[model samples]
Target: MLAVLAGCTGGSRDIGEGKPGSSGDAIQIFPRDGAEDVGPERRIEVSIPDGRLERVRVTRVEDARRQAVPGRISDDGLSWRPAGGAGRLALASKYSVEAVAVDAEGRRSARNTAFTTVVPDHRFIGYFKPENRSTVGTGMIVAFEFSRPIRDRAAVQKAIRVTADPAVEVVGHWFGRDRLDFRPAAYWKPGTEVTVEVGLRDVEGAPGVFGSQRRTVGFTVGRSQVSLVDAAGHTMQVRRDGELISTVPISAGAPKTPTYNGKMVVSEMHEVTRMDGRTVGFGGEYDIKDVPHAIRLTESGTFLHGNYWAPADTFGSLNTSHGCIGLRDVKGGGGSAPGGWFFDRTLIGDVVEVVNSPDRKVAPDNGLSGWNLSWQAWKAGSALR
Candidate 1:
């Protein structure tokens, strides 16, 4: 009996240990162990030969946030990867991975690895408007302004997308290095639902600069209203669906400081605001304490507002004041004056075309005025096309 027991013990194999002559079966991981400066957009993966993956786990080390990683085994059962549920990794973060595999001979092998991603040196953000979820007019352009200049404009523009529910071809036009606007060739259809997506996360905007924005914004188009202002005529003709609604007499910019001649959008309206010329590069030419019914036209300090201080007789027949389209209004803006009525009728995205001005056309970058460019020119400005 002792002789038999000694022989059996010598031949017995330990469970969970690799079978004899199968030492070559092993698992390999990428972003190999102790890896650093890894891109967050990269996927985690494992490879096995002569074996099948049994389980895998990935966790963020900082807060112990277990990543929702869905893994898949290759058809041949020799490889596996975090397939679907796994989102892009966090920036400048450490992650841990654990995996187990079983060989064809039923021998099990396990592995554990950790890796770190690159710490972005510079960060970028995109500021967009008309405020998310707000309803705007058909001429509204979805605009974005970057906090810093973007060097990789083509790649950045590709990351941004816009879609309309009714399905219009939306295109993006870069105003400059830092500004971008998206719109259809013509005005949007009424009641159209528009969605803008900014998928810039982890994208290299420049050397050592990374974009950190992943957002989706939706807005609706309210109605169709277009107002035409003939600077030479000194009158504003309000129209809706090609029919005249109201005609209001107005005073435009003085000859020295002519109003920008082009199509502008009603960006915002304020019941009361202080106008300081110094704020717009003028050396204290005028500083009205309370300018009423102010509507922003251009970013270069041009406004269509109530001028309570100007002579009422000058509103319809003359060009007065500095680069502003002024309407006769009371000081308090309490009554239903011409300026208040216009302000009430106007909405964000309403188109205002200023024609026959002595001044030059507004720059496309000035306060969402991209409509000043021709359709061919606008499309030419897009990097995607």
Candidate 2:
């Protein structure tokens, strides 16, 4: 009885050729032993020319998890193949096949073979915002920045699901090829819970590129807070749940370098950070090593930060700095300064709207400023339509 099998490989291979005078049956296996980089669409089967297949078993191991590949033998026992839906192999996985065959003379032969599926050369991952288990403001938008440019936007979009606990309708919008943002028609209600399910694993996002993420992230919406910055009036009205809380005096950008006007979300905050003019395309005009209470409003270096170098009276009376909203605060933060006071009450997803500025509205894709776009316009960006 023959116990070992070996075969030549191209896309598929035939294994275990019996000797001319041998009584044992020759067992054949597709995807011959030692096959590498096999595609998921290839067929997997075992067969013999003139004998009955007694048993056939296939197992697949992927990401350290092993599972059996369901299959069945032909009625005549001459062949065996994976069952429907199991015919497609898994990518980046190792498969092992074992088979036993009985010849007409009652001789038995066994064969074993193994192969490896393709490891995608190009893989994409999404870096999402708001984090898992975080509590954010109502204005928070679930955004994903994909590592690779996705050619099949519909496929990528379908792989992700964003749902709210209160059962609001949330839709996804594609910001070009690398970013996807999800939001409801209006701001999320306070105390709402949102869940993001990313099921992109092995999904073809582009030609020859696959996605490698399978995760579930969730966040809770805290109280609603939206601060309106009036550049012309040099004041910010802080509102909490439709009621006016406090009015903060602010110094917006100068006339020459005006702040962008739009609905912007607070994407980041820092107690104290350095601000350099050169970093934002401006010449070496000013560089503050310690700008306190910095709240990032846009990706283009627009910040609502503490202003110590400017005269204390510069706030509320004059638009002094370049393109950042300045609040009254001393160097290194702390104290009862308006900058620190507001920063303390802020959440990552809080909304900050700047009105009456000379500059154009902040782009919708800049930071998390999707609220700047109308609901119709936002929905128009969806690939699914």
Candidate 3:
């Protein structure tokens, strides 16, 4: 019977037999003992040809963290496999399976086995935005920037799920091969809770390059706040929940380098940050070490920041910036400065629409500006379509 149990390891040399006086052949574990380089697509299971399975326990250890792999035994006690999302084996991990079975004669038998999942030559991961458990503006879009270019866009997209509580339709749009952003048809209604599930583990993102991340992150949508910037008028209107809250003077991009015209989301905010012209492809035109209350509006370096060096009159009357929106502020920021006030009130996902600028509308893929695209156009970028 011990030899029979050893055979149940599928010819594996390393097999653990049942206790003395029990039928070792009564229990079986798949992937066998000593299995190595097992692919995730291969299912891990335990079974008995006859009698009944009493209990089954599976565990996976990766990166020094031990996690339970949930599973259930069949009603007939003939088989057991992982349940639901836990069925997918994590990459580069060690899995252990233990099972107990009772034979027709009422003799209890135990079996223990383990296997190591495949460690790919290359792995891919995604760095997502809006942070877990964070409260963000309604315009926040769940975006993922992958570490490596993805070849199987469909597989990668399918692995991710973005759902909301107040349940509006949300869809994902791929920006090239390395970025994927998800959003609803319109800005999320205030107070919506959003959850993102990234099940990229073991998913083939490229040839022989498997995804190594499996995580769930969530964020809540705060109140509605969208500011509209009129470059021609040199002013910005701040609105909260469709109510005009304030109208502030501003200086837009100069004619030679006009700001992008269209809806732009505030992707980042800084109380004070260095601005180097050379970093954004400008020829050393301006390098302010401490640009106060800087808000990033585009990936290509367009900011709505405080301009202390420019004449106080420059705001509200001049479009003097190379391509940034400027508001009046002092050297160290703070006080009731318009720049600081806006920065204080702004959330990461808030919208900042620009109008009347000669420059073309900001591309939908630039920053989190997908709101600029029509619903139909946005859906067209989805890989599932």
- Name the best candidate (by lDDT): 2
| Stretches > 4 Å off in candidate 1 | 1-121
lDDT of 1 at 245: 91
Looking at model 2, the pairs that clash are: none
lDDT of each: 0.71, 0.76, 0.75
lDDT of 3 by residue, 119-233 (tens): 6578877766776787889899888877678999999999999999999999999999999999999999999999888899999999989998787778899999999999999
Better of 1 and 2 by lDDT: 2
Cand. 1 TM to true fold: 0.68
Candidate 3 local Cα displacement, residue 204, angstroms: 0.7
Per-residue lDDT tens digits for candidate 1, residues 1-385, read 1110000001101110000122232667777766777888787878876767776666664211234456677887777776565657766566666666766767555555567766655877675677677788888998876756889889999999899989999888987798989989899998999988889888887877888878787889987889888888989999987789988898786676677799999876766554544434443344453456777777665778776666667767877555778787887574589989888888899899999989899888888788888789889989887
Q: What tens digits encode model 2's per-residue C-alpha lDDT throughout 203-230?
A: 9998988889787778999999999999
lDDT of 1 at 330: 80
Native-to-model Cα distance after best TM-score fit, residue 296 in candidate 1, in Å: 0.6
Each model's backbone clash number = 0, 0, 0
